[model samples]
Target chain A: MSAPIQLRPDETFILNVGPQHPATHGVLRVKMEMDGEYIVKAETVLGYVHRMHEKMGENRTYAQYLPNLSRLDYLGALGYTHGHVLSIERAAGIEVPERAEYIRAITVELNRVASHLFWFGAFVMDLGGFSPLMYAIQDREHILDILEGVTGSRLTYCYYRFGGLYNDVDDEFIEATKRFIPNMRKSLKKYAALVTGNIIFHKRLEGIAPVSAETCRKYGATGPVARGSGINFDVRKNEPYSVYSDFDFDVPVYQEGDSLARYKVRMDEIEQSLRIIEQGLAKLPAGPIMTEKKPKNIKLPVGDFYQAVETARGSFGIRIVSDGDKNAYRLKLRSPTYSNMHLFDETCEGMLIMDALAFMGSLDLVIPEMDR
Target chain B: MGGYFSDIFYGGKSLLVGLSITFREFFKPTVTVQYPYQTIKMSARFRGHIELLADDTGSPKCVACGMCQRACPSSCISLDSVSVDIEVDGKVKKKKVLSRYDLNFTTCSLCGQCVENCNFGAIDFSKEYNLASTRKEDFHFDLLDRLKRLEEKKA
Candidate 1:
C-alpha cells in the first residue's frame, strides 16, 4: 500500500506481522523493516477493525450508545461502559445512588481481573506456554459466570444504564462474588508458580525489549505499560473516579520497564483488584440502585464534558460535546490502547523480532479498541 | 561455577513447581460443560431477541405505543398495528391490537433498550440462545406468530 514508503539502503527486507496473525492478537498489522533477525524500523498499521464507534455515537441518542462502549474493549467491557455511563451521568447531571456506585466499582474491578487473566494466558501462550492458557481461561470462565449472573451476556455487556445499573445484583451473584475472591487469589498463586516463577518465562521477557519511562511518557502510554516503567499514574489513584477513591489499593510500579515488568504490574494489579472487590462487597450499602429522580433528556449545556476511568488496559477517557440535542454533537473515545500501541513503533526499533513480539504482547494491544 | 550451578538449580526448581501445580490440577474434574448433552441455565437478565408477552386471556399485551421502535438504535424492530371493533361492556369500541412485530435479529445488538423503553410490560427477552441457522432471512422473527406458537406449545 503506497509503495512501502520508499525504504532506504541498509534497512534490509521488510517483514509484515499480520493484519490477521494470532501473535498480533486482533487485526493489527506491523510493518517491520528487518536486517535478518533484528528489526530496523517498525510501523504499526491500524484501522482494520474500525467500526467508527465515535461516528456511531453521533448518529444515535446518548442512551442508545451504551452498547457501543462495551464493543471497544470486550475483555474490559464494564470499565468502558462505566466510563461512558459516568460521562452521560455528568452531562445529564444524574446522581448515582451509593449502592449503584459500589456495584459499578465491584463489577469494573472484576472485569479488570478477567482482562488481566486473559492477557496473562495469551501473553504466556505467545512465549510458547500452552498449559497456562488453559489454566488462565478456566479461571477466567468463573469470573465471566459471576459477571453474567448480574450483567447478562458474557463479553459485550450493556448492563449500565444512563443513571445506574440496568438491574440489581441478586443474592446469589453477591455470594458467588464473595466466594470467587479467595478462589481467584488461590488461582493467582498457581499462576505465579506456573508462569511467573518459571525460568523460561523470565528468560524470554526479563531485560528484553526494555521500554524506558521516558519512552512511555513520550507515547502517552498509560496503564500497566506506564506502571511497568515506574510511573505511579493510575487514573484510579491519580484522578480518583467513581468509588475507586474509597478503596485502599496500591499501584504496582516496576522500574525494570521490560516485558517481565509489565507482566508483574498486571499480576500485582489483579491482587489489588481482588482487594478492591472484597472491600466493595463488604461495604456495599443497602439502598436504591438507580437514582430516584428520573434523568432528563440528554442535552449537554453547550459545553464539553470529559470523564476518565481506569480500565484494565489504562485510563479510558470519554469526551462528549453536545449542542443541546438528544444525540452528541461530537463524541470522542480516548482509547488507552491507541497510545500504548504507538509505543511499538519507537520502542521496537533495532530489537529481535521475537523480543519485539514479546514486548507487543506486554503492551496488551486490543486492536479494535486502538482502532476505535 | 557456583553462580552457574545455583542458577541451574533454581530454574529447575521453579520448573518443578510449575509442573507440580499442573499435576495437582490434572486430578480435578473438568470445568467445561459437555455441550450437545448439557446446557447451562440462562440468567433472568439474559438479553436475547425481544419477544411479545401474552396476557392471561391468551391475547397479545402490546398496546403498540411504538416506543421500542423509536428507541432502538439499529431500528431492527418493525411493529404493525390494526384498529378493530371489540365488544366492551355491551358497547362496540375500536381498539388498537398488534398485527405483526418483526425483529431483524442480525442487526439486533441485544441492548435491552426495547424492554426498558416499553411502558407496559408487553415485551421481554426470550431465553433462546443457541441460535445457529444457515439463512439470514431465518432470523427475521415475527413475534406475533412466535407468541401464538409458544401459546400452542404451552397448551
Candidate 2:
C-alpha cells in the first residue's frame, strides 16, 4: 500500500478497521482518523473481494452464466437472480408467462424477508445485543429452509430462467408457503415486541447517525438506507417489473432520517414483504412456468440496458453494454451498499468509535457486494 | 433534591422492566436446533445438490437432452452420447444412449437449473446434502449406474 498520507501536527491518528475485521462485515476496511474514538475523518477502502465477475459474464453464453449473478450479493441471491433474469428477458425481448411472474414475486419477497432478518440480527449484534442476533438468525433459518427446498440451493440460488423459472411450483410447496405466512407474521410481531419498544434499542438508535434527504440524494443512497431519510424510491413500486405492480403493499418510509428510522424502515419492510408473498400465493396463476420463445445462444443486440431491482439492502442496478457479442463490452453493478457506504466518511466524523460502528451497521454495508 | 429522587426511581423501574423481559425469555422454549442428531427439516422447496434418479426398469430419467449442459453457468457438466446394441422382444435393436454424463460438483454452484430443466423427472435433488470430499472428481455421478439400480429394483 502507498505510504499513509502524512498527517499534519493537528491531524488525528489514522486507524484501519480491516478488510478482515469481524465487525466491518465481509472483508471491508475503513480508514479512520481518530482523536480518541471521536473520528476527525474517515475513508472506506474496498476491492479486497472483487472477482471481476462482470468481465466474466461477457465471455460466457447468456444461458451459460445466469448463476454468476448469485455471487454478487449472496445474502439477497434471489434479488440478483431476479434482476439478471428480468434484464436478460427484457434484452432478449422474451415474454415471461403469468405463473412465472407470480412465482418470481413470491420467491423474491420471501428472500427479502430472509435478508431483513439477517440484517436485524447483525445490526443488533453491532449494538452489543447478542441474544437478538441468535433469535433473528433462528427465524431466518426457517426462511432459508423454505427457499432451499424449492430452489435446491441456499445462499446463491440461480433458480430464475431468462424468460421464466427453471422449476414449476407444486401444490405441496404452495400449501407449505400458506402455512409459512401465518407463522412468519407471528415471528414479525414477536420481533416488534422484542426490539421495537425496547428502551435500550431506542436509546442507541434514536436521533443517532441522522442522514438528511439532501445528503442521501447527494450520495445516491438507495433501499432502506435512502428510504429512511424520506426518499420515496423503490424499484418494485416505481418501475413495477415482474408481478410487483399486481401486488398491493405500501412501501414503508420514515422521514426521521435517524438510525432508529432506518431500523424501523427495515422492520416495516419485512411486514410489507410478507403481504406481497401472501397476495402472490393467493392469486398465483396456474400456467406454463417457462416461455416457449427461447433466447439466442450467443448474441445480444448492440445496446446498453440498465436494470434495477430493490434488494433487501437497497436498489441494485446492473448496467450491461453489449456490442452484439456473447460477452458484454462493459458490465457495471451499481451496488447500493457501496454508495450508502460513501456517507460513512461524513457520518463517522466527530462520532465516538462505537457510534461509528453503529453508523456502519445502520448502513448495512455488505462488503462483498460493495467490492463486487 | 426532588428531581434527583424522581430520576433515581424511574431509572430503577426501567432497569427492572428490561431485566424482566430478558428473564421471561430465559424461561421460554429455546429455539436452538441440535444439528447432526436433529437435522433441521428442509422445506419442500429447499435447493440442494442434484442427483440422477433411476426407474423400476433401471433406466436413468436423464434422456441426454443436454438442457442442463446448456443451462449450466459454470460449464461444469460434460455429456456425450453413443449408440448401443440391445436385444428386445427376441429382436436385435440399436439405441442411442448417454456415454458420459458427469458434473464437476466442485465447480457447480448447486443451482438447480439443471434439475429444473430436466423434462424426464430423471434428476431429483435429495435432502442428503452433506457432501464434502477430498477429491474434486468425487462429486461426479454416472447416469447408467443409477439407472441399473432402478432396473434391479423393478426385477
Candidate 3:
C-alpha cells in the first residue's frame, strides 16, 4: 500500500432499527447502513421469533402438525392451513366432497377479506394513523363473529380437517354472511374516500420505493406484490384450486409498482374476494360435509406432494415428503413473507428511512411467518 | 401555482368526507364492551380447556382409552387406570376404571384433539376463559379429582 487513506468522519453510520422497534411489527431487526437520513444498505436480521416449524412438522403426525401452519400467519391463518391440508389430501388421494369444497372456498375467501382489512388497519397504524385501525377492527368483528359462530375460534382457526370441515356451518352462519357482504362494501367505499385521496397518504406512499415487474420476478414476489407491478398472476385464477374456477372475478393489476400501487392492489383484491364469496354462498349445495369411513390414521404415500394457495400476503406453499409413515419424512413451508421481505435488501437501499419503513409496512410482513 | 391550489382543494374535500363520516357516527351506540362487569356470551362451540364429562351414575365417562394421550401434539395429558371388581351374572368380574386423569394445561394448545379422538363422548370444552394464576402448579389439574368434587357439589 502506498499510504493509509484517510476517511471523513460522520460520512456513514450503522442504525440498528430493531429486534424491538414498533415499526418492525415483530422481533425483526434491520442492520441498516445509513448516510444521513438515507439508507445505504439494509440487511434484514431474522430468526428472533423462529420456532423451527419445519422440524416440528417432520416429527409429528399430520393431525398434530395441522395447527402449526395457522400460527405462521395469524392475520390470514386459514390460507397456510389450507395449503398444508391440500398437500396431505393429495398425497393420501382423499376425495373431499363437493359440499366441503364449496364451504372451504367460501371460508377461505372470507378469510382473505378479513386478512386484507386487518392489514389495512395495521399498515395505516404503522404510518401514524390510529382511527383507521379502530374502524377496520370494528368492521372485521363482523367476520370474526360469523366465523366464530361456526368454527368456534376467532384467529388461528383450525377449522378444516384433512378431508372436510370439522363441522357444518348453520343456516344462521349463512344469513350473517349474506347480511355482512353489502355492509362491507359500504365500509370499503368509506375507506377509499377517507384515506385513498388524502394528501398526506399520497405524499408518504406515491412514487416511493417503486418496485418494477422484473424486480418482483427476480425476488419471486407473488400475490399483490407482483400484481402491483402489472404482473397478471394469481394462484386462485391461474391454478384454480378448490372451486375458484367456478367463480368469475377479475385479478386487479396496477402498472405502477410503488407503495401506493401495492395499496390499491390489496383494496381491489378485497372487492374480488367479496365477489367470490357472493358466488360461493349462492351456489352452496346440499350434501354431507364429511366423507364417510374416514381413516383413523393418515399415512401419505412415499412421495413428495405440494399445494399453493393465495393468502392475503402472497402465495403460501406447503410441500411434504412422506415415507408412508404417520409422520412426514420432510416438510417445507414456503411462506410468502420470506420472499417478500428479501425485496427490502435491494429495493430499500438509497430510500429515506421514513419511506423505507412505509415500504416495509406496505409489504405486509408477518415476521414470525417469515422466520418460521 | 394552479396545480398546488387544486391539490389543496381536493385534499380538503377528502378531509371533509372523512370528518363527515366520523361526525355522523358520533350519534351511534357505542360498540365497546366493558370487561368484568359486562361480558359477551361465548358461542355455542367456543373451545376452551378440556373437561371430563360425567356419566348418568355421576362418574367420569372416560374408559381410559389413552387415544387422547397418543394424539396430543404436546403430550400434555397423562392418565392411570385401575382394575375394579364388579358383579356380572352373580360372578366377580374385573373391569378397568379411570383412577387418575392429569392435564398439563401449561403446554395445552386447546386444539380439541382429545374431544375428537374420544369415541365415547367423555370430554368437552369448558368455557373457562378467566384463567390467571401465579404458581405453575395451578395449571397442572387432576381432572378425575375435579370431576368427583364437581359431582359431589352438584349432589
Candidate 4:
C-alpha cells in the first residue's frame, strides 16, 4: 500500500482504491484525497507487478529474453513479442521471409481484436454490466481457439522468433480466421444494439473524463487513448513495420476525448483490425517461414536500436543497446500504459469517485505492463 | 409533456433492446466447459513440460552432451554426467553417461529452446497440463528416472 495522501483534517480524507481491488484491473493502488465523494487529488502508485524485465534482458541472451515479453501484457502478449522481435531483427540485420511478415501481421491483428474484445468486456464489467462481459468473452474465445491452433498457447504466446515465426500457419488457421471476420461483424452489430445503444451505458460514459489532445501529447499517450482525443497517429500508418504498410485499414479517431470516445475508438479499431486480418489472409503468400541464414546465436551490432509497433492498448516500443554481445547492454521497454496512466493524477482531480473509476477503466491500465 | 413522454419511450425501447439481446443469448448453447468432468481436448501443439525420449534399447537418447543444460534460458535444467568404462566390441572404452537429470519445473518457461537445441531429438514437450501438487518439491522432476519408468511401462 502507498503512504496516505496528505490532507487537512476534516477538509479531506484519504481513500485507497486498490492494490487489491478488482476494479483497478491489476494490483494498482490509487491514493485519493476525497471531499464528500469527490476526489480532491489522486495519485497512482505502481511497481506491484514489476518483474525487472529490463534487467532480465540485460542478463539473458537475446533469444532467451523473448519469453519475458509476453508476461508484460498477457492479453496482448504477441504485440510485445512482435515489437521485441522486430527490434532484434533490425539490430541484428536479419531478413524475415515475406510469408512470415504477412503471418505476423495477420496474427497480430487478430490478437489486437482479441485484446480489444477483452477490454470491451472488462470495461463494461467495471461499469457494472455483467452480460456484455460474457458476450465479449464468448466472441474472444473464438480468437483464442484460432490463435491456439497456430501459436500453440492461448494467452502468453511465445510464437514469434527473431527473424520469423516459431512455426507456419496451416490452411485450417486461415479458414478459421476467414470464418471469424463475418462472425465478428455480426457480433459487433449485436454489441451496438445491446451496449452501445443502451441509454444507461451512454449516460455513464458519454462526455465523462474528456482528455484533450494536448493532454495526450503531454503524457505521450498512444493507441485508443490518443486516438480518442483525435490525435490521428497510429504507428502502423505513421511508422510502418513488418507488412502493415502493404495493407489498408482506417485509423479510427473520435474527437470528444471522453470515456465514450475511447470506447468508440477501441470498438471501431476491432472492425479495422478485422479488415487488416482479412487483407492479410487474402495477400498471404507461400514461402519459407524461417529465413535460411538464421544465426544459431543471435548477436546484435554494437549500437542502439528501437522498434515501435501499434499494440491493442497503444504503441509499444523496444529499445536495445547492444555492445555486439549476446546479451543487451541496456534494454528499455517503452510501455504505453505507463504514459497513458500518468495523466490520471491531473485528470481525476475534482471528479466524482465513480466517474474517476470509469475514467481509470477507460485508460485500460495493465499494471504489469506499466510496472515493467 | 410530449418531450418527457418520448424520453421515457426511447429509454424503454433501448432497455428492451438490451433485454432482448440478453434473452437471445440466454436460450443459446452454454459456452461454459464443466471442468474436472468435461475437459476440452488440448491441441497437439500444446506445450506442457519437457520429457526425455528413449531409444530402441530402452535407454535415453541424451548423449550427456549438456546442450540442453546450456541452452536453457531460466537455468532450470541441471544434469550430472559420469565417465564410465564400457566394453564395446570386445574393446574397453570410456563413455560419458547421464547419471542424474533434474528439471526445476517451477522456473521453466516452456520456451522449447532445450528441445530445439537437442540434435538427437532426445527431448520434447509432453502434453500433460493438469499439474497440481501440494508440496513445492514435487515440481522438481528427475527426468532420468521418469524416462526409465516410461521404458518399463513400454516394455
Candidate 5:
C-alpha cells in the first residue's frame, strides 16, 4: 500500500450559494467550492418549485392542461403557451386556417421579441448596468400593449388553441405593430449604445463562461447560448412550422465561445426576428383564426409526439405520450433553461463567484421552467 | 512593460467613450415613471382578470348554455343547469335555472376562451388582477354574489 499523503488546511472553502440567492435566479441552490474568491467546483440542486407538472398532465385532459403550460415559464408565459399549443396541433394532425397560422405566428414573434428584450435588460442588470433594463423594458411594454389589445391579459397569456387562436387580431393591433417596428428598431440602437460596446460590460462578459461547440452539441443548448458558440441549430429553420416557412429571415450566428458572443447573438437575432414580424404582418392572410374542427370532449389519439419551438431562452420542446384519452398519459417539457443551466456547474469552475453570477445571468434562466 | 502601457491606454479610451454616453443621457429627458403617484396609465385593452357579469334585470346573463363550460380547456369551471316550473298566465312554463356554477380561478389559464365562446356575451374579463388570498377557498368566485345583492335591495 502507498503511504498516505498529507493535505494542507484551508485548501478549499465550501460555499452555499443558496436556493434563494438573487444570482441563482429562482429557488436553485448551488453548492460551490472556492479557493478564496475563485470557484473551483459547483453542484446545482433543483426541485424547489417543482409541482410535478408532468404527473399533473397525466391526470388532466389535453384541453384541461393547456392553461398549465403558461405557468412553466411564468416570466415569459407566451413562449410556453405557444410551444404546448403548437405541439397539440402537430400531434392531432389538425389543419389550421391560414389566418389562424398568421395570427399565431404574429403573437408568438411578438412574444419572442418581448422575451428577448426582458432577457437583454436582465442580463445587463446582472452585469451591474441598470439603465438598459429600464430602456429595454420601455420597448417591451409596447409589445405587451399590442398583445393585451387582443389577448386581454399581459403575462401568462393563454390565447392559443390547438388548431386556431382564442380571438381575432383587430385593425388597431395591426396599426400598433406597424408603428412599433420602427420604434423597436430605434430602441435597439439605443440598447447597443447603452451597453453593447461598454468597457465594463465587455470586460465582465468577454471570454467568460466559454461553452464550446462540442459541449453545446453534447448538452443540446438551444436558442442564443448555442448559437453564440457557432452552433447552426435553430428549430424554426431546421423544423419549419406555422407560417415561418413563408417568411424570410436569417439565423444569426456567433463563433465566439463567450458570454459577450451570446449577448451579440441575441441582439442580432432580435433584429432578424423583427424582420420576420414585418414580413408576417405584410403578408398576413385573412380568414378565420379558429378552426371549425373542434373535437368533442377534448379527446386525442394515443401516440408519442415531439414538437420543438424557439423560445427566448432556447429551443423549447414538448414530448407528449397520450393513451387515446381526453388527457395525456405523460407530458415531458424539455425546457431550454433546464438544459442550458446544466452547464453552470462545469462553466463556473475556476471563475470568481461574481463572474459565476454574471454567467448565470447570461444563460437567462427562468427558475419555474428549470424546476418544471 | 510596453503591452501594459498599451492596455492602459485602450482601457482609458474605452472609459472615456462610455463616460461621454453617460454625460449625454444625463442631459436628455428623464423617462422614469413614478409608479404610484404619477401613474403610467394602463390601457383598457389590458386583460387582467376573469369576471362573471349580470344583465340589467339583475339576473345572470349566462343562460345555462354551457358554452363557456364546454370551451374551457382547463375544466376549472363546473356548471349545472336545472329546469324550473313557473306559473305564467295560469299556465305552467319550464325555465332553465343555473343550479351550480363553480369556477376554480386558481386553475384557470386566463385564456379568455370561455369569454370568447359565449354567444350570448354573458361573461367578460375585468382589468383587476390583484387577486391574492391566504386560503385556497378565497379564489373560488360565485357569480350569484351580485344576484344576492339585488335580492337584498328588493327586500
Candidate 6:
C-alpha cells in the first residue's frame, strides 16, 4: 500500500513493512521512504510486544522475576536467566558452586548454538532458501533435547537460581553433551559445503551494507554485528563472568562489515561454542550443584547492581536498584537486539528494499527481546 | 568468450558441489518425527504442569502451608483449608485439612516456583502435555479431587 506523502513531485512513495509481516521475525513495523525499490529513509516503531517486565520486577520478588527473563529472548533464554541470577548473586554476596558455574557455562553455550542455528535457518529463509531452515531446526532439536534433559523446559527455560541451578544435571546430560559436540562439528562442515560456497548467495550479500566500526560504537552494537565490523569487544572476554575465563576459545571477527561478514561471524561462533562446551564438559567438577548457605529470602543491599553477559545476539545487561527489600525498587533490562536494531535507521539509507531486509536478518533481531 | 565460458564452468562446479551435499543428505533418514501419529517420548525432566503429589497413606502430602499460593507469581494457585480436630499421640490436636485446591492452568507459567517453595515436596510437574481442549473451563482444575482419585486408583 502507498501512503500519499509530499516528498517530491516525482515517483516517491512510502511503504510500511511490518507489525504483521512474516519477514520482520516479530511484531516490528518499519516505515520506509522508497523511490521504486530503494529505501530513502527507514524508521522502526517498537513497543508492540512490551509487557512491562520492569514494572513486574518492582511488584514481585527477585526470585519470582526469574521466569520473565525467559520471555525476553525465547531463543537464548538461559543467557538472560544467567544474567539475572549473576546480578542478584553479586548484589547479595552469594557464592555459587564451581560445578554449577561449569554447568551454567555449558548450558549457555549450548543455547547460543541453538540460537545461531535458528538464525542460520531463518536468515537463509529470508534469502529465499527454504531447505536450510529444516536442516538447521533438525540440528537445533538435539541441543534442545540435551537442555530439556536437565533444565525441565526446552525453550524459555527458568532453570538457574540465584546461587546455582535448581537441579543438578545427571550423568546422562553430560554424556549427551559430549556426544553433541562432534555431531555439531560434522553438521558445520555440511553447512559450509551447502550454503557458504554458493555464488548466488554470496553475490547477494557480499560488500552490501557495510557498517563501519564507529557506527557500531555509537549504536552500542556488541555481538556478531560489531564483530563483523572488526570490533573485538565481547563481554565474556572483556568482563569475564562465571567460569568463562577457564575456557579457551576464539571470538570470531570479520572486517568486511557486510551481511556475509556478519553471517560468517555467527557461523564461526558456532564452532567456538562447540569448543567451549567440550572444554566445560572436561572441566566439570564433582560437587554440590548449589551453595550450602543460600539465603532463604533474597534481599539485596541498598545499592545499584548491574550484570552483563554475552548472549547469542550480543551483550545482555540487567540493572537492579534495591532498597534492601523483597522486591526490586527498579529493574532495567538492556537487551542486545534493541541496540542492534537502532542502527537500522542509519544503515538502511540508499539501499534496495531486498538488501535492507537481508541486512535486518543479518542483525539477527528477536523482536520480543527488543520490545521487552 | 573464453573468460565467460570459464566463469560458467566455475559456477557449474560449485553448483554441483552444493548439489552433491544435498544429494547425500537426501538418502539419509528423515529427521521429522511425524507428531500425533508417531510421538517421540518426552524427556524425564519435561515440565508440563503442576500436580499434587500423593503420599503413601493415599492422601496429599500438603500440610496446607499456603506457601505455594503466596510464592506463585501469577496468583494461579488457590487452596481452601479448614482446621479439624484429630487424635495424634493420644492427644487432641487441630490440623489443617485441604478442602479445595484450584490451579488455573490458563495463567500458570509452569515456572516451578510453587513446586520449589512447597518445602513439603507436596507438588511436582505432571508429564501430561497433550492438553488441547474446546472449552476454556477445562483448564481450571481441582487438584485435591484429582489427588483423591489418584490415591484411590493406586489402592
Best by DockQ: 1
Whichever of 2 and 3 has more DockQ, that candidate is: 3
The sequence of per-residue lDDT tens digits that candidate 5 reaches over residues A285-337 is: 88887788764466668889888888788888889988888788888989999
> Model 3 fnat?
0.65
Q: What TM-score does chain A reach in every model?
A: 0.96, 0.95, 0.97, 0.97, 0.95, 0.97
Q: Supply the global lDDT for candidate 4.
A: 0.91
**Candidate 1 C-alpha lDDT tens digits along A179-296:** 8998999998888888988998989998997889999899899999999999989999998878888999999999999999999999999999999999999999999888887563
Q: What is the Å distance of residue A290 in model 4 from its true position?
A: 0.7
Per-residue error at A356 for model 2, in Å? Answer: 0.5
* Descending-DockQ candidate ranking: 1, 6, 3, 4, 5, 2
Q: Considering only N, C-alpha and C atoms within 3 Å, which residue pairs clash in candidate 4?
A: none
The CAPRI-style docking tier of model 3 reads medium
Query: By summed lDDT, which 10 consecutive residues of candidate 1 chain A come out lowest?
Result: A293-302
Error of 6 at B83 (Å): 1.1
What is the TM-score, restricted to chain A, for candidate 4?
A: 0.97
| Pick by DockQ: 5 or 6, better one | 6
The candidate that achieves the highest lDDT relative to the unseen native structure: 6
lDDT of 2 by residue, A319-368 (tens): 88889887777877888898999988887778888887888898888877
TM-score of each: 0.97, 0.87, 0.97, 0.96, 0.90, 0.97
User: Model 4 over residues A225-255: C-alpha lDDT tens digits?
Assistant: 9999999999999999998889889999999
Q: List, residue by residue over A1-372, the lDDT tens digit for candidate 6.
A: 898765555577889999999789999999999988988889999989999988999999999899999999999999999999999999999999999999999999999999999999999999998888888999999999999999889898999998888899999999998888888999998888788987778878999899999999999998999999999989999999999999999999999999999999999999999999999999899999889976677989999999999999999999999998999999999999999999999999999999999999999999999988
Better of 4 and 6 by TM-score: 6
lDDT values for all models = 0.90, 0.81, 0.90, 0.91, 0.82, 0.92
**Comparing chain B with the reference, what is the TM-score for each candidate?**
0.94, 0.74, 0.95, 0.90, 0.75, 0.90
Tens-place lDDT per residue, model 3, A253-278, is 99999999999999999999999999
Better of 1 and 5 by lDDT: 1
